[model samples]
Each structure stands twice: as C-alpha cells, then as structure tokens.
Target: MSRLRTHYPLRATILEGRFFQLSENEILHSISLEYTSELTRLHSAYSIPEPDHPRPEISSPSFRIYGTEYDEVNRTLVGVLALRWIHFNDYESFVGCQPNSVKLRPQSFNWICNIYRKTIKSNEDLFTLITSTVINDLGKAPSLTTDYAKLTGTDINKVNHDMILYQVIHHPAVAETLVPSLTKVSSEHKHDLSLGIKLGAEFNFGQLAQAENVPACLSGLKTDLKNNPRAFEMRFMEQLLDIAGAAGHTDYTCARKLVEPIFDSYKNVYDVAIDIISGNLGLREGYDIILIRRVELLQRVGWKRAESLNIRDKEKRALMRLLCIGGAASIKTADLYYQTFTAVNLSRTVYEGLVEGLNVDGSLEQPAVQPTYLPAMCGLAIANTANGTTGEKMKALTALLTYLSRVLVIDKDSLSFKRLPEGVIVVERDLRQTIQPILESAAFKHKPDILTDAPMPRDQVAKMADGYEWSFTAISI
Candidate 1:
C-alpha cells in the first residue's frame, strides 16, 4: 500500500461565530448531517417521485460524503411543485373574483385557486385576482366605471378603469351579447348601444373576414378579383348599381332591409322634436322651422295619427327636405305628408307614444347616427364628376371630404383629389389616415402598448382601405 500523505482538514464555520477543526471523516459526517435535514424539508414540501417515473432514482449513495464516500442523493427536487401550485392558485383566484358578475366554471375556478395556494404569495397575485375578477363578473362586457362600480363593490380607482372598459367592450362573448341587444332596445337606448355595437362588430368582423382559410364563396371572390381584373371590375360595378337601386326602392318592406335600424333611430328623434314643439315645452324661436318641418315630415310619412292642412307650402318644402334627408323617397314622402297634416299632436302625445318607447337617450342624442342624405349624397357626388372640369371635380372632392370628415377622424395630407387623364376626378383618401388616428388616439390615452404593428395580409389591407376612395366627374364649362 502507498504511504498516506498527512493533510489537515479545513475548519467548519457554523452559525453564531462557532468554528471547529475536524478530521476528513469528521467533515464528511458533518456535511451528511445538513444534507439529511434539507432532504427531509424537500420531501415534505413536494410529492415524491414515483418508482415508475422515468427520472433516475434518488439514492443516498449518490451524494459524496467525503473525499472517498457519497451520502444523500436528492436535493434539487425541492420546491417545484409548491411553486407551481401557488401560481395555479393565483390564476384561479383572479378568475373567480371578477367583479362583472360574469359566470365561470367551478372547475376552472378551483384549479386556479389551488395554484395560488401552492405558489409564492405576492402583489402580482392580488393584481391578477382583482383584474380577472372584475372582467369576469361584468359579463366580459365593457361598461362605464360608474356602471362597473355599481356592479362590483371594488372602487374604480383601484384598477386601470379604461383598460378594463376596453377589454370588456372587445371581449367576444360580451360583443356577441351586445349585438342582439342593440337590435332589441327601445329607440332611446338604441342610439347608445347601437353605436357601441356597430363599432365593436365592425372591428371584430374585419378580423374574422381576414382569417386564414376563409370559406369558399368569399375566397373565390377574392381569387377572381386577383386573377381576372376586367371581369372583376365589370361584375363589381354591376353589383354596385344593383344594390343602389335596391336601396332606393320606396316600399317599406323593401327599404327597411337596407335602413331599418338607422330609420328606426331617426323616427325616435322626430317623435321627440314633435313632442317638444306641440307641448310648447322647451321650444325656442330658431327651432320653429326645424320643428314644423319635422312634424310635417313625420305626418307625411304616415308616422302620425292626426293631421292639419293649415301647414304652408314653405313648411311642406322644409318637410320634404327633411324627409328626403332621412332617405324616404317619393311614396314614403307622400305618406308622411298625408299623416302629419291629419294627426293632432294631442291625439297621441309624441313623447309619451314615441320618445318614451325609447330606452335611454333621446333619438338625436347618439354621435354615430347620421342624416339619411349622407350615403346617397356621397354616392351622387362621387358619380357626377367622372368627366367634369377640374374646378367641378374640386367641388365634388370637397363635398366628399366634408362628408367623410363628419363621421371619421381624417388627416389633411390623406385627402387626395386627383384629376385623371380621362378627366374624372378621383378622391383617394387613405383609410389609415382616417382610422389609424382614432385607434392610436384611443390607445395613447389609455394603455399605449396595445396598439401593435403586426403585418396585415393584402386582402385585409384592401378591405380596411376600401371606401376611402371614390370617383366623380364635374360639369363641363
């Protein structure tokens, strides 16, 4: 046997400034003692690996005890399961406590709760819990902070109120619920809900339309446009003419399909104006023509129950203008004229009969509601200047701009009215200039990071950019 070299072992440092010199064997035994305590802690905290598990088995012999021997084997598998459990519990707690009264499954609730209980405790957990609880409870629908506060006892100040509202509005289930509600509400409530639903639906529908592997019919249309330009152009123009003619029909059933919700909304406004005018309630001098015109138009459209022919031709003309502006054509106009002239304001109170039938705000109250002249006027302005003078083209262009500006936020540079070689004035406004600003402004005012620059597909880009352009011809001088 080789002679053993004598080397002194390093002293062990312990708590409380205690130190001890030990032989090699003594040092090995001391390490083993601490290792055993740690192993016990880990074993108690986590589920032990099953014998059938693929990982290497834990064995005491695998741990090195000294220069020559090994001791306890497993120490790394300590707090993993405990940490995972805590995270899951935290997630569940967040989902469970949502303030919006949105219902969630018990299984999901329990799963997240268990994870939180097992994971590390921190403010992050509380924050998630609060947000999730609020969103879930609110039916996953966007609501005013005051509304949410009314529903959830939690103070609105405690969380990012705007973000919560945006999420609720955009939530799929909430949006779905709201779309139908928009159609059902009485006229007063219609304006508020309809505008909100339209905005949300347009955003969501655009996303759905752009999804990969869209249905065959829509995809076929996309392909035809891309592959056969001449055929596509002819077909598109034909379809446009057909739709416009269909939209202009005077029969109520035929017309309603094209303008039901909007017309219904306007009817509410007309009713309110009539009430205010008739009751001598809140009537001002400047509004007399407006009120009289509204009453005549309502009656002529067969919207009222009684009549009076004492209404003058000037008033009739004003009423005709109002009716035309509201999109009722010749037949509907005649009906309105006949109805309003015969019905008494007191025969059936306009407010009690019509305004009261609405839900929240008066008919004219919502921002998104537009006069019926909007679309037709826009189309006519676009159609008339196809071969006109530059000055006439410019006038039509200005009219188009004015129309769009009324409904959308527009950038000055994005408005481009160009005279084509064929002399048609083409108005080309970039939709991005109109729409992006709105999205950007909303995002910046709230949580700015939500606005993203993800690459959009070509078809999506086209749909988004559509209607931002129109063509017209001016009168030859």
Candidate 2:
C-alpha cells in the first residue's frame, strides 16, 4: 500500500546491447537523491572496497548530495546494499523487483563495462567486474596502505582478517544458509540472515516497518535453543558474529578479526576444542560461542528502536561517548595498568582459579604477566571516541581526571584499588553537569534501548576472563 517502490532504471539500456561504465560517483549520487538521512547511513557506515581486498572500512562521504549527507563509502557493498534495497520487497519470497534488468537510472547507469571482453550477460558477471574494480581501487587507498603497515599483526593476517570481516562474514549467502534449518521460528518471526539483511537494507532506504512489529522480524533472529532446535552447532558462532555485525555492535570488527585467533586461543587456553569448519565443537552449549551469539539480539533490538523512530547517528555517537565515559570511570577505578604487569593482591580462591585458568597445560607460562586488562583497553577505546585531536583528547582526559578525583575511593599506594565509596557514583559531576546535555541535545524520540542496552552475557564472560587473569596477577592469592 506504500506509494514508493524499488526499481532500477539501467536495466533497459543494458538490455538494448549497449554496455555502460559503472561510475561509483553516479551510483552514490542516485542513492543520495533517493534516500533520506534516516534511510541510509548518513554518518558512520560500513564500506566494502573490493571482494579480493575485502576490508570493511568505517566509511564516510559516500558522495555528498544536494545538501543532505550519506556516510559510509564502500563502492562494492554499498552498491550491493543499494541493489538489494531496489530489488527486495515485502513478500517472504521477495518477488517485487524487475525480473530481467536492474532498475538503474539513465544518467547513473554506467558501470565498468570497458574491461569486459566477452558479453556480460548475467547480473552476476557485471556484479563481479564492478566489485573487482572497487576492490582493486580499495587496495590502493592511501589510508589502507598506511593502516595495513601499522597493524601490529602481520600484513597477511590483517588482510585475511579484513576479508573475513567483509567478505565471509557479511556475505548475503551466509545468512541464507540458516533458512531451511531455522527451527521454532514463528510464522511471524521466521527470520533468516537473508531477511534480516533485506530488512536492514530496506530500513536504510527509509522503508522501516512500524516500531512494534519490528520485533517479529527480529524475533526469528534471537537464538533460543528451543526456538532453533535444528541450529547447526558449529555455524552458530559465525552466524551470531554475522548477525551482530549486520545489526551493528561496537566491537564486531575486532571480534571478526580475532575469530580464528580466538578459536585457537580457546583451544589452547580454556582447552575448548572447537572445529570451526566442520561445525563440530565437542561441547554442547559453549558459553564463549553463546557470548558472541547473543549480541545479535542486542543489536537487533537497539537498531530497530533507533531506526523506527528516525534517530540520527550523531545522537547515537553522543550517547556512545557517554557510555565510553562510564567505561573509562570503571577502568580508572580499577587502576588497572597495561604498560607492565605490576603485582596485585587477590583472595586465595581467586588466585587458585587464575592458576587453573591461565595454566591449562600445567606450566604457568609468564605467571606474573597477566593481560587481563583488555577490558580496560576496550574502555579506553570507547572513551577516546569523545575527542579526535590531541588537544581534545587532552581535554577529555583532564575532564576525566577531574571527575574521578571527586569519587572518594581509598587511596592505596597508587597501585591497588581498595574501595572506600563502596558503590558506583553512577554519573560523575562533570558528566552530569556538562556531558549529559550534549548527549541528549537532540531529542531521540525512539526506543532509546540501543543507547542503553547492556551485553549481560558478554559482561559475564569478560568478568570470568578477567577474573582468571587477575588470579595470575594477584600479589597474595
């Protein structure tokens, strides 16, 4: 019943035997013209450069149109997301698009036809050449080269990680794999990765469903073992990662990069023998896997709420800045140092647990060196988002130090934290007086759940992981 429909204006020209160049600028321009700030990623979006050099950069300026802005700049993925948006529709079978030709507009229809020698007949072939050009171009980006060199991990590993993040994880097919086997999904909630993605794309184009019904679309996504009885045990983790990434969780990019490494770590550290490819982890209900999987629910709920009500991305960032500030406060309270492992006191049981957890192979390798401070590092990453420049970072830090000094914690040798306040301050003085207004500046009339939801399961896992590390570092345990 909606007045607007999805289509491609270019399908006719290509059908007439005339090849066209797929100009990146033209495609982005059409998107800008058709979509609104609420529809697409107006600020901070996913970008895919190439299928070969697959790294999903947090892109921007997809081409500034008339006056409004669209964020996220990946020629390949953006184009595909746009294509899906044009082609997909409400029917569960997805029957709304023009069957023969893409709905490319005349002015913006040119794609990379010059490189083709054979007639590019199938839509797939054209897609391939177009994305290849994007990937080749992306591989050559100055920022990519710089960032590639700077990764502490090897270049090959970095590219591999990026490929997994963009290509393997974000593949439209990966989500589709779940459909046939998806179990216990209600009539209204029969969501697979394919549908969720299509819905998200539609949402990006400002075709989001009403707020309340959005849950039905996402309910099929939430992983209740009872609901999805036929769930593939092994693919669950990857599916979760894909869903979460698609739905927009903060640390997913890093999570995807660490997937294989973390799998190896789990095998080594916790002795979790998970075979990722075969979908066979000997254990039933691995909490680590669950920890990763449940985040999709958080992202789905949060994103639906935000998009349904048309909340702007800036407001989201402002809220995230506040959350990061809170994270910084917790990290500061712990006084956890990452520079070098300093001795710390822990209770006997805590120490014993650390010994057991850290020393899976009986030998305590670098017992004194506990890298349990990754959570704090996560915190720092969040807090740093408040400022971009050296001056701004300095100011934020100053503001933080000023705020923390006000909390009445017992000072202990400037090394260990002995609690005095015995409770979280909830909000510091500076944050309450100055920061709160900035975050809530533009009223976000949406559900606000995305801004406020906590990853309870992830937090528990983090706690356990940190506790194990603390056991290693404990001065007394």
Candidate 3:
C-alpha cells in the first residue's frame, strides 16, 4: 500500500475539456503533450509501438457512472431514480463540500488521468494501467443499455456491468479502441495488451462473490488469461492503483483513514477461502491475510422514493446494524448481510422483519428476487460484537441460518443446484467444508466468546445445517 501523502497534484491543465468527443488522433496528441517525456520513456522501456489506428470516440458516458436509474421506460421499476451527474471539472474543485457523496461522482477521462498520475509511479505498469482504466467502464455506455437488458433479462439497476463490458469488448467501437490493429506492433504485444485490458475490466471477485451462484471466473477472462501470469499481475495492479488513486482525491483525513485499511489488506478473501478448502492451512506463499471489515456506506439516492418503493438497501443496512456484523456474503442477491446481534436499540422485530421480508419474492425493489444457489453457504463475518450477550448472538445465528435454509436447498445435491452457468460444479461438501474454517477463523480472531456458547435448538440446527457436524464451540482456527 502507498503511504498516505499529505498533498497531491491537482488536474492536469491540458486535459480540461470534453476530450471524448475529439478524434482518436487528437486525443493521443493531447495525452502526449501532457506527458511527453513520460510516454517517450515508457515506450522505450516496454518496446511497444505508438498507437497508430484511429480509435473509436467514447459515447454515452452516463450509464452506470451514476448508480441505478429507474424510470417508466425501464418498465420494471416505478417512479424516477434520482442520480447525481456532475462534470469532471466540478469534481476537480471538490475540496470538502460533501465527503460522503464521492461514489456519486462519475469518472471522466480527466478524472481517470488525475488518479493515474498520482497512483502509477512505476514505468512497468504505465501502458497496461492506462489502457485498462481507459476502457474499464465501456459497459456503462448508454448506447449498450438495450443490449445489456437483452443479455441479462434484468433492468440496468440489477445487472452485472462488468459482464456487459466483457460481452462488448469486441464491438467495433470498443474493439477499435482496446484491441486495435497496428502497423508495426507485434501480435504478442497486442494480444497481451488486449488480455491485460480484459483482465482488468472483468476481475471483479467481490461483486462475483456477492452475487448468488456466480463463480469467481464467471466472465471467462480468468480462464482465458489463466496461463498469463503477467496479465493477472496487471489486473491486480489496476485494482490497487484504483484504490490508491481514490485515496489521493481529497485532502480530507477521514477519507484516507477510511480507505487506508482496504489498501493495506491486499489479500483476497475469496482466494483465502479457496486455499482453506484445498487443505492448505498456511497463508499463501507471499501474502498475509487480514480480516477485512467493510462497511457499506449510504448512497446519495432518493431516500423517500426508495422507502416508498421498499428498496432493500436501507433494510439490509438496518439488519447489519442489528446483527452487529461487519460484512457477510448473501446466499441470495442481498450482498454484505452480516451481523452478530443488536448493535443498536432497534427492536428484534426490525431484524426479524428484514430477514422475513428477504425470504419473499417480488416484494423488494428488484423484480422476481429469487435465490440462485441452493445448498450454498452464505459467508458472514461475526466480529466487533463483544458487546452482545452469548444468548443474543446464538439466537441471531439461529435466526439467520434457519432463514438461509428456507431460501437455499440443503437436503439434496441435485444437478440443478450443483451446476453454475460458468461450468463450475459447486460440490455441497466442498462449500460446507470451506465456509466453516473461514468463519471460525474470523470469529476466533474477532469475537472468541461465541465459540463456547451452547448450540441452538436441534430442529433449527438440522434445518439449516450445511453437513458440518453441529457444535457451538468448534474453534478450528
């Protein structure tokens, strides 16, 4: 992780306008003018030819840049979904107007460049990082909204934008921009660069884990580039640089404090979970694992309208507060649903209502909200809940586990429940074996007392059991 720097250079004066409308040649000229010496040095170091083909100009930049929009035209959602749309120049001038609303700001070409200069100090990462960031949000283009809807059968609100990006990587506009043919460029250079861009665009393990029944490599980029370790490294660098770039955006100390931990904990939780299942108790050769506590902050959407529409965002947060857990992966689509017991004064009814409401279909904001994976373990972290009673934590655990059983099929390993769209077979035994050790490790480190408490009712345990021998104090870590 990059150390927190007190001062960061502001926007480059050369990139001040709507450059996306310019021709590809003009765009390249402007970039070269801004970083003439740096590009010269990088091209020499990497032995790559300068971009020759005229790339496609970016169009419709307002898609997922701001979060979900629901108007009458979408047909699935009622009422208007209010989203923030501000120019890149406005974001450049943001000092401390509203720290909580940073996610609302969309990334313009200038914003991308500002972050890029701050984060990428190494010459080795220059070309891949630049290309990846440029085309990372191609799926967010409004020109592809109808195509996205057709691909997923869901509104833009609930679609996987990363998948959409991967799907259109070969489209004329996107292909010309990302994987363009050049006169003197080696095929390997073009192939590897294209692979790196695709890897960065689609390597969203967090979102994949959050979505039910989706494998970590559902987008096929991982399988495509599995043999290319350099491509994977480039993808990882892009993600790290992204976080580092955001950390430098403001002078606000609180923002740095909030993001610094996520930067420091570089190990992927999903990867660690995989290792545990493979019978490797040791940490990965070079990486040290840390228990990451992620808090889903409030989005700047229309609250009154969302509440009227019974949007599940607020309800999930309410449940998080009540359960007192930092983070949890949902067995369904309600990602990050983890807690131990009541952290606030909210009634148990509120917690119960939140859980019960989630069990029903077509009740929440999303249409036809159904559980995708059966016999699947919803990974939840029980931490920072030393304040709760043993009985309270136990009851909360029972309630959650029982609810999961109702939603996911725990009895049989039928073919329908076993197979995922990406051809990954999720063995029930492997999932049960995997989640137990990880959860136990997290609990042992964060809240040790719960391991010694008595078990929940036998009937409830049986209903929700994931084939792990039921025990209250099975502290494997």
Candidate 4:
C-alpha cells in the first residue's frame, strides 16, 4: 500500500472594499495599492536565494513589488499615476445602481468592468476569459504560466487571479505592458484553475486529433460500404460499360457476367433492350426496340463519354433515324452499316432515356444534316437507277451535275456549265431538275435571286467547282 503525500495549502486574504464605491481614478489607485501589497507578499514568499556574485552584478531587476517594478521605481510610479486617473473616471458613472445609471464609455475602464461582471457570472465564462487573455498576452510576450499550461495542463481561476499568476510566472514589467492591471486570485480558487486545465486539455486533444489521422479514420468508417454488394455491382457496371462503349476490347465475358444478373432482376422491357444493344446476348438479327432502349440507358448514364466514340457521328446518326422512319426498308442494309448505325441510334436513344429518367423537360431532338451532303447521296441514287449506264457521256454528266449542284448550293449565282464544251447541255438540264426541290426549301427561301433565269458563268462555274471539290474532300477525309 502507498501513502499519499499531504501538501500545505496557501491561505487567501481579501483586500478591503472601500475603493469599490470610489471615483474611477480613486478606484484604480486603491486597486493598484492592493495589487502592490499582494505583489510584495508574493515576491517574498517565492524569492530566490541570493547568488554568490554581488548585488550590483545582477543585470536585470529581481524583485516585482505590488505588481510594479522594484528596481525601475520611477517608471512604476508613473504607471501607478496613470492607473489612478483611469479609475477616477470609471467610478463616477456608477453613483446610483439604477437601471441604465451607468452608461459604458469606450476606454480601458469599461473593459475592466466588463471583465469583472463576466468572470463573476459562470465558470465557463471565466475559463473563456482566462484562455483568451493568456493566449493574447503570450502572443505579445512569452509568459512562463502560459508556456507551462501549453506543456502540462493547468486551470485558471478568476480573471484577476489568472492575471496575477501570469505576471508572477513571467516578469512583472512584461505582464503589465501586455495585460495591464491583471492579477490572479490566491490558492483558494484552485478549483477554477483545475477546471480550466481540463477544458484546455480537451481543446488541445481535438486539435491534435484533426492534425493526425484520427478524424480520417473516423470518416472512413462512414464512406466505406463493404456490406452493400448492390452498390458495388452498380459502380463496377458503370466502369465496364464506360470502357466497352469506348471500344476498349471484345471482353464481352466480363460485361456479360455483370449485366446478365441486372437484366434478370429488373426483367423490364428496358433491361431486355439494354442486353440486346450491349451485344451481351443479341436478340433478333436486326436492330430492334430493345436494342434502342439499351443504348438509351447507357446514354442516360454518361452522354459526354459516349459521344467520344467515332461511330456515334452524323452520318451514322442520320442512317439510324432513317431506319427508325423507314423501318423494314432501312433494315435490309443493316449489316453493312450495323456498327456505325447502331452506335448513333443508340446514343440518341440513351440521351432520350436519361432525359426521361431525370424527368427533365424537352424531348431529345436529332441534329440536322448539312445541305451539301445531300447531292452526293442523290448522285448515288441516280447511279443505282441507271441500267447499263456505260457511256463516257453519261459518267461526265453525272460528275458535272454533282459538282454543279454542290456549287449551286454554295454559290447559287455562279452556275456556269458552258465552260465544258462537251455535254454542257445535259449537265445544265440535270442541275436545274435535280436542285428544284432544294431551291424551293425554306433554307433557300430568302435567296430568290438564286432561282431566277440567270445562266451560270463558264469561267466562274469552273472556279466554284474547284473550290467545292476541295471543301468536300477535306470534309470526307
């Protein structure tokens, strides 16, 4: 068994309250006197033994008396005078304790009064004041009490007592300069000091926890979802779908494993559609409604990433729309452009699916095809129509009409087919008949001069054809 050591406790003595009702200047002088008496006693009680060297050999002041200097007596006297003046003015306003009798004026006197009232009210308030004061004073000059508190936990009692301890531990002159007229209560208020130490330790612990990984460890617990397999599956599916849509590889086995179960679980019409579109398990040979729905679902997840694929461009998109419009008529050549057509059509479908999923307004609209590309498609149609069209004359007419029609759209007024001496008549006639509907369209409605009886210039027509071919080839490549 261990025996606890007993320590002798210091007794507290209260100064007389005569200065309480005095004028502000008188009050300050009395308070200074009381502080001086307390300081004298503190200095004697905690005095260090005389050094082996002579008294004159000491470079700095050794004694702090009455919370003032012992060596620099003149400066201490001047500070005491200043404190008296401040107290005189502070005491005058509180003559009667009536409501609103004492109006607080801006100065050090009001600060003193505010501190007094708050410290007397609650322990938390006192702790806050002591902590703030020590931190503030330490910021200006180092204090041993504050340094000790920083290292080992310590509590501060009333503001006055805390201030006194602060001065005793640090030098009196420095403490006065940093926090004027502050002092700590005697050992009777040790409980207040202990309370402060506990609070301070807690505050420091919080800061340390944040600085280290303790908080991070706690946060990881919230975000880590190891128990939920469904969420894991969803995230995994999202990754695989993104890679597959990006044309990464033919690793359909991995994708099939994830998608098959989701399909079975949902078992909706849309889920079937997604399976068909993803090629996890192809349904009917041609593209169907289910395939379109799958594409729509993928689009709903990530449109920007999906759009980066080369197959999801304008020509493919237009062909998909044509299939949707023409149905079986467009399905015959589905295999020829299946990859390209499927990507475009699915992208559009995905976009619409996402918009619907999110309940956003406005339907997904298809982008318009440029007018210039129309002539090339028309030429293909014409070529297919010809029965054994083998003459150089027929080939020349087709090439000439294609060029002239493109130029007519780009430079309507410069239709000069006469530059070609051979077969100029057939080219001119074909241009007029082939472009008739285009000329009547809303795009050309505003340009009435283009449709008039103006024959194209021979030299200008040749130049425009050259420009048209360069642009067309550049776009194709």
Q: Largest TM-score belongs to which candidate? A: 3
TM-scores of all predicted structures: 0.16, 0.26, 0.36, 0.17
Q: In candidate 2, how many Å is residue 250 off?
A: 17
Model 2 CA lDDT for position 306: 23
How far off is model 3, as Cα RMSD?
A: 18.7
lDDT of 3 at 320: 32
Off by over 4 Å in 4: 1-15, 30-139, 143-186, 197-477
Per-candidate Cα lDDT values, in order, are: 0.28, 0.25, 0.31, 0.27
Clashes of each: 57, 14, 2, 22
lDDT of 2 at 179: 17
Poorly placed runs, candidate 3 (over 4 Å)? 1-125, 145-159, 171-174, 177-190, 196-226, 245-258, 268-477
Measured on C-alpha atoms, candidate 2 has an lDDT of 0.25
- Per-residue alpha-carbon lDDT of model 2 for 162-278, expressed as tens digits? 222222213334322311122212332233222333222211111000010111112122322224322222122222223212212222122221222222222221222123213
Flag regions of model 2 displaced more than 4 Å: 1-20, 33-63, 68-278, 282-342, 345-477
Ranking by lDDT: 3, 1, 4, 2
lDDT tens per residue, model 1, 1-477? 011112221111322112122333343344334333322322222211223323222322223332321111222211111122223443342222222323333553353334334431333332222112112212222233344445444333222222233333444444323222222223433232323232221222111111111111122223222333322222222221122112111211111111322323233333333344244334222123333444554565565422542224443433333333333333443453334422352133332322222111111121111121233333344235435544433344343333333322212232121122122111112233233332324332332222233221111111112223211121110
TM-score of candidate 2 to 2 decimals:
0.26
Query: Model 3: per-residue lDDT, tens digit, 181-248?
Result: 22123355446556655543333533222232222222233255546655544554455333332322
Reference-based lDDT, residue 119, model 4: 38
